[model samples]
Target: MNKYLMTIKNKQYIRFFLIPTILCLILAISVVFVLLNQRKGELVDLENRSQLQTSLLSEKIAGKLNSLELVLSMINQSARSMDLDNETDRERLISLVKSQLYLQDDLEGLCILSPDGSKIYSSFHIITENLLENQQRMITTHTRQDISFSLFSFIDNKAWHLVLSRSLFDQSGDLVAIVGLLIETHSFFDLLSVTEIPGLERAILFDTAGKTIATWNQKDALGKETIHLEENIHLIPSFSDSNILNTQDQTINAGIKTVRFENSLLTTVKLGNFPLSLGMETFIDKAMASYDNALVISMSVLFLFIIISLTVITLLGKQVIEQEQVQQVMMDELSEKVKSRTAELEKLSTLDSLTGLINRRKINSLLAEQIDNRSKEPTFCCIMIIDIDHFKLVNDNFGHQTGDEVLIHIVRVLQQSLGPLGTLSRWGGDELLVLLPSHSAQQALDIAKDLLVHIRDNPFSPDIMSTISIGIAQYREGELSSDLISRADTALYEAKGSGRNRVILG
Candidate 1:
């Protein structure tokens, strides 16, 4: 209720009459504002969800590629484990891969051929039927240092596989037989079942050359664009794509915008990296369905509340003065109390009683929030944990007052060195946590070292040259807030461990 109504202490019945109407207005405004805010929030949430899913699919594709590489690695390991190049070890080497993953039958052949392309060891067992066609292809495609891959099609059998061949070298780098690993593409597709997000409905993977390799389709998909077509997002027209291979993996999620044949409606495209640029594209209709009932209920409730208010206001015209006045006064008092309490809580939460620097809790909260929010343009950031070396000994020898003054002096120097762009916090009894937002770890260390030098350089009131040790660390993307602090802590311990008056970074 507004303040004007409260000053009118008379009109008891009138006060009662106006109260309901004022409450109804407050409620109506609040509902509208909340609904609008929620709708905005919903849009941001959807975008994040879609992008995150796309990134995940990309990671899945990269993972499959890695798996292929691992299979090749295993084959190479087989040749080395048995010394395949030595004629005496030929039988054992031939049986190596066959025993692994229980694939003696699935593995068509294993042979050790000489550099001149003549058979040295043959597990295929056909005496007269020479391997000229495949052998010549392999020899031409690979040298002693070269690796090759080929798709093998069996006309009389029902199996799908591609073979990767790697030449083995000795410790002195001598040419050995080409090791082969048969990869079942079906198994790679089967591994795609691990993720559980819906409308993650479908994904198509493209090789580095943009050739379609595989896809995972939802049960309801039309399955045409998803069918082994060329791996071009432009060619498909239903999905959008993204890349995620730098050092680590990432995912992207997009929705099927439109079946251009159906309509050219804009679609959501999720793209990611694992080894391929895979994406999930779906119609916006799924999102619409999720929002439908909540939106309708919200509007319906708003309308119903407005009608009820109107009916009550008609029945009791001006009988709402006292109620409105009382509520208005209470709200003002509550608001003031809340404002004062918030400040008190902030002080209690952040400030150290002795040093007046931020406390551990506030420093930790700031560090976590900053890491999460400041990934893209981490202009500069560093952490420093400072401990008064032999602080307990100082308290025992001199006094707790002198120890407290040392802590205060430490913070004072930090404030002078760091200025406003940095933060200082009391981490524990004799330690201060410092954060320099626009500085590197080295920069922070320089500042810390300078402080130590100043302490040693300047003699205090009673001619004491007090000292402090510091730990420092820089930040990296996706790294937890703990990473820097842990490094700093270790560094601080090192500063103490190796002898005091130095800055160390783990």
Candidate 2:
């Protein structure tokens, strides 16, 4: 009977241990399954986030490219009438290029190469020998594109380059010069230097041929040949499927799948109208291991440490959540500040500091855009060039501070006179440009007369009497903005030659 009792006690103990073991096994399986699903969900969320970020970065890059294109166009137009052989013209060209380079800090170098590859002018203080060799090779292999972008590396420096170039054309459409700007790779990286999500292992940008152009902190990979393609063969299927959906207006749903070699997730976005794409990768195994480790610790402390572990985890999680919330708020505030500063800078760039009127460079850009639109629609546009008569005399009599006050007062009066019918911009010292869209030459002339009468009647200062010389030129079909402005300037000279306060129409 005692032996039977011993056997029964042993069986009961075995049964007790077996039940708990089975329960533990079931719980482990459930946890593993839940963790796997959670990891999958995290990967999906990461892909979505990456896709949005890539799209935003691509749009930013595209905007920069557009700005570059506009710059090239301006340089081309400004240089078209300029005889570079003349010392004054060459100096003016150099000044223009230097000003542009100053405005765009990303431009490491700005140079105008002659057709024979001779360096005519350069913004950088580099040895011209290297520039000459590179440009000569470029010219030799050049296709007749008006504007082009190319990626290259320097033999002297590890810095990669994105060169934006435009062929300067003469009045007869003859290619005269090759104007180009070199942008450092770091400028491209700035677009990606933002908040990064966890699980994101890599963020890369590549050219159309799958060559790595830029990557986050991946300096060594730059200018490498088709590294992205070799590393991301599995992404080809996804890219192919989503290529049709990617557009400037649309945010594409770039679905995530496993990477080629590693246990990873990948997504990509193509920059609009550019032969470049942005890509992101996330490692699944590494991202999941931390959660698994925590789970194991929790399971190991089933009874004795459960209460302590739960309390610690709860407090830590709360703290982490609070910290994350604070970080998110701070990030949002920083982003807003950056955006505000950028907008302010952009606005300041386009406006004259003294008079609060549009600057000459901005006016040129506006006129160019208007001309392009008018060329398509065949609309009547008028450019009026106005100069302050005896302005230097005012500065000579009064202080420059007083002269500044006079300029500001004049701009305000012009703004009031023009109202919404025209745009008033400062052309240079004591000169202003009035753009009248969809207006005839006679209408512009009438407006100019009114302006002259108003200025002459209401003086900026009682002691210093001021009048304006007016030059009016109506836009002709297929004429460039520079050409129109030039004609108006000729008329301005005529007005000044005839009389200070007179109006001349060209």
Candidate 3:
């Protein structure tokens, strides 16, 4: 039963990749669907708002026109009753205009102008008798636009007002005077104050020149293009008919725009007849914030799922391979038997019989891995070639066995000295190599000096104490492993030529 269970475990069929991946894919697709749906819904909302803005802009502007209509009514009424050439008729026209404005509060003052821009009447009794006679010196001279309603600045600069003008005529069709009323623009912008999708959206009114007449935010823009392509509400098309009802969303540019028009101007409004158009936009930050949050959550779940799946696969693979248990069992059985058999091989592959340090073959492989994996951290390292000082004399004087003993003891010392900072290897018979990982030339010099001091100070064996010569060179980019090793080796030759037992800086 146990064997059968192990066989079943080795089958490696327990994983759920087909399902989990499909499910992950499905979940990812669902997230994309959710994102797309949310975006679509928001866009639909934006489209609806744009439509309503177009309509409401007409209505809001129509409401704005309501004040102008009242002023036009004043102009039309004044011309109906009076024969303006007579003094009685002229005074009657002035009194009639003032009386009509008596109930209207937005009217700062009303005025009648001749074609030559002379004020025929003033609503304020404070008007001087000759104020009309002095054309240039009177109040402020405003350029006249015929038959249109506009918001204009008042003289005291205390407030803004909507001005309406129309061609006034007698019943017999004789031309008389121009009547205009100043309606406070503040009230017109106030009606448009509204909020949608929390504080993410805003509404605005643009004039015939694409200049914003009013906005929910206080924009000091009377002439600046609100419908400029890279500007304010962002490139509303020129009005084709009296109304513009559709638009496209554009990608963002780097520069951020400020909201210029203000008042309490925002509200969802119904459709009506008006010349001005309305536009509402969602703040990119607010709209994309929800999408970003969803993506982050989805990515987190995806990464967690991937990690768990990989871990499960690895564990399952280990169970199937059974390599560790097999190897451990083999090693345990051979532990005693192989010990005495390899006696002549005290060489133990590449171990210096004198020292237990690694051979050059292992160092070569280690260097290959280090250099290849160094993409993660591309930096310099130092290579040092170490050789014993006057080794022929040491061996000849002390006999080969004692000499061998000295080499072994020195290898042991080098291995212990490097610790984990470097890879210590027996380069050839008496030569050694030390690769100090991520170490600079100066650091390598210090290390070489330290090692030399330790060797000269420590007793080599019962009979002798000795020191080593080291030549250190820093590794550079594009240098082959062999070339780097050769450089250090050359430095070592230089050290030997210089004297014995000194570190030659390369």
For all the candidates, what are their Cα RMSDs to the real structure? Answer: 44.1, 54.9, 24.9
Worst ten-residue run, lDDT, model 1?
258-267
Judged by whole-model lDDT over C-alpha atoms, candidate 1 comes out at 0.59
Number of backbone collisions per candidate:
39, 0, 14
lDDT tens digits by residue: candidate 3, 149-194: 2233222234333345555777886556666665555565465444
**Per-residue error (Å), model 3, residue 38:** 3.0
lDDT of candidate 2 over 46-97, digit per residue (tens): 5677667666766777688678767887988998888776889878877888
Deviation in angstroms for 486 in model 2?
99
* lDDT score for residue 415 of model 3: 72
Candidate 1 lDDT, tens digit per residue, 1-39? 343554464444345445666777788788878887887
- Better candidate number, 1 or 3, judged by TM-score: 3
Q: For model 3, give the 10-residue run with minimal summed lDDT.
A: 243-252
